[model samples]
Target: MADSTTPLLSRSNSEAEPETPRLAKQVPSLDDTIERCIGSFGWAQLLQAVLVSLAWVFDAQQTFISVFTDAEPTWHCSRPDDPSCNSSANLCLLPKDAWAWDKPSRTSVLSEWNLACAGPVIAGLPASSFFVGCLAGGLVLATLADSSLGRKNMLVLSCLMMSVTSTLTAFSPNIWVYAALRFVSGFGRATIGTCALVLSTEIVGKRWRGEVGVIGFLLFTFGFLSLPIMAYINRESSWRTLYLWTSVPAIFYCIIIHFAVRESPRWLLVKGRKDEAIETLRTITTRNQSSFRLSVSFSGISIVPETFDGNLYSAIKALVEKKWAFRRLMAVMTVGFGIGMVYYGMPLGVGNLAFNLYLSVTFNALSELPSSLLTFFLIGKLNRRSSLLVFTIISGICSIMCVVVGESRQVLQVAVELVSFFSACTAFSVLLIYTLELFPTCVRNSALSMVRQALVFGGVFSPVLVAAGRKDGFLSYGVFGLVIGCCGLFVVCLPETRGGTLCDTMDEQEYKEIIASNGGDDV
Candidate 1:
């Protein structure tokens, strides 16, 4: 083997590279090593992947819980016979005593904090603060999973922080305090989805790679679906009850992860922890497949960290310094920004639909069922770049159509909104999978986090848009359409990674690119 300066990659798992001694001939990739050691997906693999995917459920809970918690409860004439309160007039315009919220004032933050009439800025503050925290956390914590914390530790810490902050959020005395606490919660959970996706996929064989990502999507859908149910159950209770319900269970999940899951073997191998990687491989493999080894072939498997300086920012530096990685990053992020806008905005803006909030949200969540199932069955047949482009376009078209359909036909508007959200859901899932494939394992988590940050960055404005859209559909829905439509075009700039190999370092990726360009799988 050459010195550490030699840049090399293991051969494809399915075939050998044509000999080229100058390039250091064919060697088995860690992925190949993974298949040899853990040939089939076993019970241990299933449990760990399922456990990681489960985080998507809780993360979804946090993402959409505000839809119910901060909602402006329905108000009506204090007495049925009261003429002073007109159902036709704005609640803000009427005298305080003329009307009352249909539900108890404690049912939501809007009535409890008197934010219904306090204007959009104050009413939208908490949700906005949460997304801002997500953006900040994404930027700051993006590399930690790829660098020091490793996927398991990063996930546990993120879940713990998010849960504790959510628990404290239930006790906020005022709106300002509530908004700040929500910010902390958002910051804590920022890396939850990113770590889960990266860790889950890394632990499995390539045959299950795309499937694992979709499984997370399905769980995320389940999580989204659970919110409306829980909120409905606590409809008569304080908004605080919903927060407590979701947060407490998450704390228990964190403990289970600490005891049950192992760190990603690919991540361990990247950090040069050979023994631990071997142990992880052994644990996830079947009882019959006992001869797990990194092997002499793996002895030459050179993995490098993202950071050149060996500092906290090294991984990011690696991503940006490399022209190809930087280009891929910006393009995917643009698409994510659009998807995030429509994805988050539609749920929050359901209030503007002139339909029942609970039923409207239920319809929105149920849309995920078909979309996820389709993605799962067709994942192998789908082209990562094209799937993203088509879904984003479909989502944007339906979103704009929501405004054109108008509120006169309530069912139609709701249906169109559901379609838009469905496309966004599919695009969101495909984009996450695409991000996983585009970047290799070495800097995979950080790159995925940045893409999610782009998604969150788009979400930061959703509350404000939803707040304004309460009066006009265009501000939120219309803008959501235009942005996603334009951004989806960026997909053309990205390479199609439908059947690409998972390389360990940037150099390996460059080698893959050379092979791809030369019209051969190897040199």
Candidate 2:
């Protein structure tokens, strides 16, 4: 290889000077070489990616089940002896049976628990507590994935915990118990998506990262779409059935994950488990039918940590000490916070829209598919800055338009709301891909979790705003629009990452544009 001081000439100049030998190409780093050895596109890789993404479906199911289970069923005057039952005026004056539920009491939590007339303060408890759990869980357990636990172990544990807690929620005797159980379930839910994303992307070559990530998002949308159907099927049954259906499949999925999936090879190599990494790589190559030899390729490489200490404290220290990393983390998280507020707030706010809850939820869920597909397409073609800028601005404009259209024009309002949601969906997908590209494996899980936590942290305010009702657009649409638009402006600070390789260690990730300026030599 040429020395660092060598003056590199263009291909035409090099050819013209026949006596000058072309500088030997720089030997690829161990991580880059390993990625090439393991083929970029392969059947084995795709199968594993799809399997990991299946978890997102169940994660989505548990997330929005409350929309159906907590819904208020129809009610009417039922008691014949009550004076208001026969009269047409002043139902509150004769409170006896004047607002009796029309369906069986067990149909929904609001109906079964006699919370029909309960104010928003009490009614929104279950759903709101779940997100609170999400925030708490993500903050507390985020580092575990980056530390001793690794990606696979943390993912399996979280899936099992979420499933068990949610199942137990079905047997709750009171709203408090249900809310507590949901909180715990939310805690478990926090890591499932993050781990699935990290593990799936890590298992494959860099070219497939965006596609694999989008698979999880698509599965999530499918899961969201499933809720309304399940609720409709169990409409005559108890709300507990909804919990039962969603939780059971997740429990079974945990078993499959344990038996089928392997730890991330990139993580294994970086953690000094080269033997295990070689074995995993062999499996990948054999499945992909590649000709690369893991033993010969990594013979002289010393795969040691650059600055990371292989623990939570080290991960935090490394990220904070690096100027560029902390800035990237803060910038992306800021954008994530705004996107999260609208992303988490939208479905919950669907009831406030002047439309049927089922249809509105369905419309919003359906919007995710096309938006995700668009993201999948754009991720390959557009740079991170352009994609984030366009999608975030579009979402914000659509949200503002929703407020301008008003509720009186229900069709136009719904149309605009869907457009806002679709744009938000694309923005969120792009954000996830960008975050994955921005951070390295050492703190990838934690950094991604921080971005998610920012989103959930923003979400903590959403329920309160949503509880304010649909009297005006200020609470739901206007706030979502303004915050997302304002926060998205921070994206300009981030560098473009399209067509870049995934950085396995903090040292591998580029910072400060120094490399680009110095003829692409990594410092």
Candidate 3:
């Protein structure tokens, strides 16, 4: 055997046995190891990737559920001669008997809790509470995937918590209880999207990263679209039915995750679990190949010899320590904040449109299809910086148009809003995938989580604006436009990582940056 003293990445081993002196046993980094294991994007990898990415479906459902549950049911004059329910009169000013909701009182939170006459702030509380929980959950659970729990375990925990909380939300007796449950539900799902995307991309080969990224967004779109359908089916029933519909499937999905999916091999290797990493890689990549062939493939492969027996927040500390990483994190989070504003705002605020609620939400959800398709097909060709810039700029302009159109031309306003939402959806898709490429594998989950939280932070303001905008358009739609357009400017500061390999360490990343800066030659 070659001397144990020799390093894994040495260029030469001239002092080795003359018989096999040139057969140098160079060690592979985690990226190199994954690339080799996943020689081609076979059905196995796709199945596993899809399984992991499916978490976004539930995440999207939980996110937009309020669109239906908290919706202010349409109302009409109770008596034909009653002028008290005229368009100009405030609903709060009218006698309770002057108007009646078109839908059953059990179909919505506003009617159930007698909150329809509550001011916008109080009416918007449940949605805002959910986002606040997401913020808290993100901060509290940020590093778990990167450290103690690992990606698969974190995903399981998040899905389970989200499902459990949502199931309980169905039984909420009052607005306060509903809002509190929504908060806890938000906390439970805070990491679902991040963990799903991070874990999916990390498990497969780099060649399929963009493809895998699109899968998650597509599934998320599916989830978003499903909400409107569930609401329509239960349109005559209680809103509580919607919660049971989404939560029960998600709880079962947790079981599927437990039995079918494998943890990310890159994550395993990073945590110093060599045998587990190798075994996972084998199971994912090798369907027909024998274990002996897999062993040959792993003959000279080795990890970076790193240990993570440190505290729970080691990855966060590593990110804080690296100046470039910190800068990258900040820039991306800023952009995510902008994207989040429109992404979460538009659907919740769809009620503001004079158009049909179910159709409007369906249109908004349908817009995600083209966005994902565009990103999926052009993922290889699109410039991250340019695409992000263009999408957000277009979204901002269209959002601003919602103000110009006013209520005079309702059709035109909805059209402009759709365009803005479409562009924002496109930006949102690109931003999450782009984030996966920005940081090293060790801190990727944590970094993505922080960025997602920033997006959630932007969402925290959306419900308040959407509620208030019932009177002033600018407070909701106009602000969504400005935040996305302005915050998106931060993308210019980050380097383009399209087509780049994943780095496992800060030093490796610095080396790659230096080589890139030097025109592909080592300095």
Candidate 4:
């Protein structure tokens, strides 16, 4: 019963109304428009996106490999004179009681390397450092993404840097050296994520932005799924081998991008490089075998407007000026922090439970695929706030159920854990999409980075909680779940954004106002 005329059910009135053409000319065909939008890359560009996401997946997997490595049986041992001993000590001098050696008679020997005790702590350093670097980068250079640096250059730089740093991490001789390389690696990693998003938005036609954004994230999840297979194959290999193998794909991707990708036509037009932008558009039309007719005018397209003085004070002022903006920021920050705690904390916490750690992690990872698929299908059909609320409630219920089906019942515990995995995955997938829609393009990167920073902050404290909880009880993880569920309450305050056109600038605030006046219904 949906109207065909209304493409996006969530669009505000002003947004639904087409803007007057700023340019004097217009493009002639859909083929031309598509071609001009993406340039010479064509279908191959999809591979480039996949490769970039794959590099990130590899980075995440390497960071987590230590967890699996640590759980190996080699890391455990039996005490001397214990009835559990399966063999006599090598130093035993008598045969009367070979299995039960006294302290003096027993010679404790390491059956395997105690890598598990150190691996998680050591491997976690790079992921932590990467997020820290992302926080700093978001605060410092996020604005530059749309202005001077341009999305293409920043993306290429990020990719190359990650490749080199990841490769070096494999060769590090000591833990300190590895950690330092990881910090640099993380800087590049953060740049890739931010820049790829910016680049995708700038290159695509305005009408296709939402679709492209969701697709990019879908590819990111694909990367996440692919990484575990790579790890499973190289499980017995040294950690160095894992890093080395992961970095190779990145190197290839960097080369492909260097040769194939083009600058954003919108970025060029905004920078007053009209001729270059036109030439790029022409190239796209030629490739697509269509005519370009759309007007490309700079008069209407504000070039990084000087709304306020460029300073920290000005940025703070901009965020606080509107009541709705402030509310949105606070809600995003709170939900972001909670989701982060659950997203990163749950897997680590589940692994610590008295179960097969690998199987548990695999189940958790597997559950995310369905969530990602569900988001792809439901995003255009459901309200953002409604979707978020539903998933958060489900995930919360599952968390509470985990407490009920504790170690006392292994089968029930496993089933509840599976439920917990899927619910958390659903919450995370929807959150990423919702956060992107909540902000305008002018400050999108900054807003997203801020939310991501909150998530990282949660991740920072999560390991400690997991470690402490294992030693004490499941109280730590339970607290984490309860906190996240409580945070879901904030989503009720957010406006629905499904099927809405992405807001490119704050000048579009009238659209938001219109949507707000409609009793939270889609325009």
Query: Which residue pairs in candidate 4 collide?
Result: 25-295, 26-293, 26-294, 27-292, 27-293, 27-294, 28-293, 70-116
Of 3 and 4, the candidate ranking higher by TM-score: 3
Error of 4 at 20 (Å): 13
**lDDT per residue as tens, model 4, 1-523:** 3342222222445555556333211211221233444452444444434443444454455445445433333221244455444453232233423332122111111112222235456545545565566556556655555556666776777677777887887776655676677767766655566566555544545344444555655655565555556656765556566667767777787787666666666556545676676665555432433223323322223333435554543434555676676788789778877777777777777765677655777777777777767766666566778777777767767766777667788778767767766776677667766776776655555566566667667766777777777755456657676877888788888876665555544445434555568655322
- The clash numbers for all candidates, in the given order, read 1, 0, 0, 8
TM-score, prediction 4:
0.76
lDDT per residue (tens digit) for residues 1-523 in model 2: 4332223221334544435212112222544555655767577777778888899999999888988899977667777666646675434455654656667889888778866657776788898899999998998889888888889899999999999999999999998898899999999989988899998888776677788889899999999999988888888899999999999989999999898888888788778887887877777663443333566556545543466565566776787888888999999999998898888888888888757878888999999999878877767887888878888888888888888888789899888888888988888888888998888887899888888888888888888877764666687789999999999999999988887766666765643244655566442
| CA error at residue 287 for candidate 2, angstroms | 6.3
Task: Give every collision pair in model 3.
Answer: none
Looking at candidate 3, the ten consecutive residues that score lowest on lDDT are: 18-27
lDDT of 3 by residue, 1-523 (tens): 3343333344464555345212122224555545655664777788988999999999999999888888888887888776656764566788888888888899999998899878777888888888999999999999999888999999999999999999999999898899999999999999999999998888767777888889999999999999999899899999999999999999999999999999987787667776787778778774456656555555555444433445778877878777788989999999999989898889888888877889989999999999999999988788888899999999999999999899999889988999999999999889988989888878899999999998899888787788789889999999999999999898999988787778775666666676677688321
lDDT, model 2, position 314: 77
Q: Give lDDT per model, in order.
A: 0.85, 0.80, 0.84, 0.58
What candidate 1 gets wrong by more than 4 Å, as runs, is 1-28, 79-82, 287-297, 304-307
C-alpha positional error of residue 430 in candidate 3 after TM-score superposition, expressed in Å: 0.9
- Give per-model TM-scores: 0.93, 0.90, 0.92, 0.76
Q: Model 1 scores what on Cα lDDT?
A: 0.85
Task: State how far residue 356 of model 1 sits from its true place (Å).
Answer: 0.9
Q: What TM value does model 3 have?
A: 0.92
Candidate 2 at 518: error in angstroms?
5.7
Higher-lDDT candidate of 1 and 4: 1
